[model samples]
Target: MSGEPGARRRRLRELLVDTAPLRQSPAFAKLWTGTSIAQIGAQVTIVAVGLHVYELTHSTFAVSLVALWALGPMILAGFVGGALADVFDRRLVALVTAVAAWLSIGTMTVIAFLGVEATWPYYALAAINAASATIMGATRGAIIPRLLPTQLLPAAAALSGITMGAAITVGPAVAGVLVASVGVPWTYLLDAVLFTGAFLGILSLPRMRPDGERRSAGLGSVLESLRFLKRAPNVRATFVWDLIAMTLGTPRVVFPAAGALVLGGGPVTVGALTAAFAIGSLLSGLFSGPLGGVRRQGRAVTLAIAVFGACTALFGAVLLVTGLTDAPRDADTPLIPAIVLAGLALAGTGAADNVSAVFRTTILQAAAPDDVRGRMQGLFYVVVAGGPRVGDLIAGALATLLALWAPALIGGILILGIMLILLRTARGFQRYDAHAPTP
Candidate 1:
């Protein structure tokens, strides 16, 4: 019986995220740690700033504009930023962008501390910070492949899963508490301080210049990357699957309507439903050891996405049942049982999506040529940033035209049908081996 306990502990260790990448490379370890810490602070600022805007203007439109202003610049940065990383030394690029982001944070901090009471300062600075962060993210993505060996790419990506999981889940909650307890000024200051970790990580790295045919950061470079994508079926498959899953299968669009019409509990229900997805991603990252061992990552991604679609459908079905029943749609009283089931389904989707991300990132970093890695990563940032926005429009339109539940139900079905077709037809993607990555 005592031996059995020890055996169970060993199994648990095997199931957790692999730490080999951290143990093997000191440089990679520091970079990952700094990036993780900085991202958490960045998330804190994001949430707190939204609340701050609301407090200042009492306008929800103003708060919406906060995201609206940043989104365009960030997407533009993704297009141009890759060219910068490919041409310049990545460490230098990261350091420069990190400084830009920090300066934006510092400026916001000062404005809030001085009781500026103005809205434009916040809007302009936040947009700058967002764009800077986008560029920094691209540079760092390009840098990671240079730091770690090809075999450990999946493990590195899994650790990134842990980073994102913490940043999105823990950071926003902390931001809310901090803004309520102290103030917006302090929250911005905290982000500024937290951002220094990125500097430490960037400083630890050696200069990393792109290895192959590099071009200046401009339209020509961006166009060349799109050309590369056309030639690389495996890399292209990653983007296609992600776009389909995110665009069609995202679950958040219906949360508000579902809460009011079917699920009940309104705002609290909405928050719980949102957090449940991040929580599932966090848990999966914590127990992702077996994920690091998969060689046929392309096949793994397909299966993970399939599960994602199924989970979305299940969530919709749960809502459909309550919508049909006599569940109180008061938007006040809680429906704990239905909420629990819905949360679980959303959590399943999050877990599956995170797994898909882990392998898709591995393929991107490992298969793409060194010279255009930054460009590829840049395009990756664009897809990640823009896919959800498009998804939002699609989801919103479907919900409006058909029903609140129809978008999720229909989107889930579409993802399943499309994924299966891709699985069978895109034989190259299914056969892609992590051992000898091909782009």
Candidate 2:
């Protein structure tokens, strides 16, 4: 009887997230720690930049254009940087890009300290910072497989989710408080200082050369990656499914309006909604033990995204209910029921999204040939970076034309339907085995 109890305890422990990757790999541990700290600072700057732009222009379009300006440069950097990682030393690429991104943050701090009122400078520097960060992200992703064995990749990805979830959960809230109290210059300066951790992390990594035939960094290399992806059905499915989920289900663009008009907690409600999603992600990563053993990675991605779409749709329903109710319009009015429902729904979205991300990342890292991993990762970065922007546009336009809730409701349904069709048709992806990676 005592042995049975111990067996049950062991089974329970097995169901929780494994931290073995962090425990086993010192290099990965340092990299994960440094990136986690720096990510929080980066989120601070991201929030501060939007607030600063809005204060200067008083035009949401101008603030939106800030992201627009960064998008093109970021996309270009992902491709070029990925190729560079394949052709040159990945550690050098990561280190140099990290330095450049850090310098951009420093420049932003200087501009803020000078109390520059020029919105153009903000836009220009933000573009540079975004481009540099994109390149750094691509390089770092390509280097991860080199740090750990194949069996632990999923665990590493789960750890990454924890880092991301913590950063996102805490960073923006801190930014809001700091920007409100300490002023924007200090907020920018904080990020610049904290970013030094990322530099240290990249510097700690040993030089990593391409494991197989190296591709020259340029348009031709980019084209070659595209050609390879064309034949790699399973890999193609991951990207397509991710793009679908992101484009359709992301609800962030409507958050401010929802807080003010429907939920009535205003800025607090907006922050709560965002934090709820991050909390979900954090918790999912915290208990991701069983996920590492999942062999049908493609099926897992599909199912997780389906759940994401459902949660988003549920969130839309909450908004719709709030709209129909006699909820007070005052910014301070507490729509506690609605707020709780919305938060829960968004939380569900976050959890599902993180699971899907873990599977997609593992599949990519495990399946792609080492020689082409950098290029593929670059394209992956581009998709990941670009999808949310497109989602924002879709949500914004639909919300403007229909209602705040309409975008989520409509988009969620679209995601579900499209994903189902893709899953039904893509037999190879449906049966993909992690142990026998195919791309």
Candidate 1 lDDT, tens digit per residue, 1-439?
8799999999999999999999999999999999999999999999988999999999988987898888899899998888899999898999999999999999999989989988888999999999899999988999999889998888899999999998999898889889999988898888999999998889999988889764678898889889999999999999999999999987587898888878889988998998999998988898899997899999999989998998888888888887888867779877889899999998998999999999999999999998888888888888898888788889889888888877778888888888888789888999999998999
lDDT at residue 102 of model 1 (Cα atoms): 96
TM-score, per-candidate, Cα-based: 0.97, 0.96
Each candidate: RMSD: 1.5, 1.6
lDDT, candidates in the order shown? 0.90, 0.89
**Per-residue CA lDDT of candidate 2, range 230-259, in tens?**
999888988999999988888799999998
Candidate 1, TM-score vs. the true structure?
Answer: 0.97
Model 1, position 234, has a per-residue lDDT of 94
Q: How accurate is candidate 1 locally (lDDT)?
A: 0.90
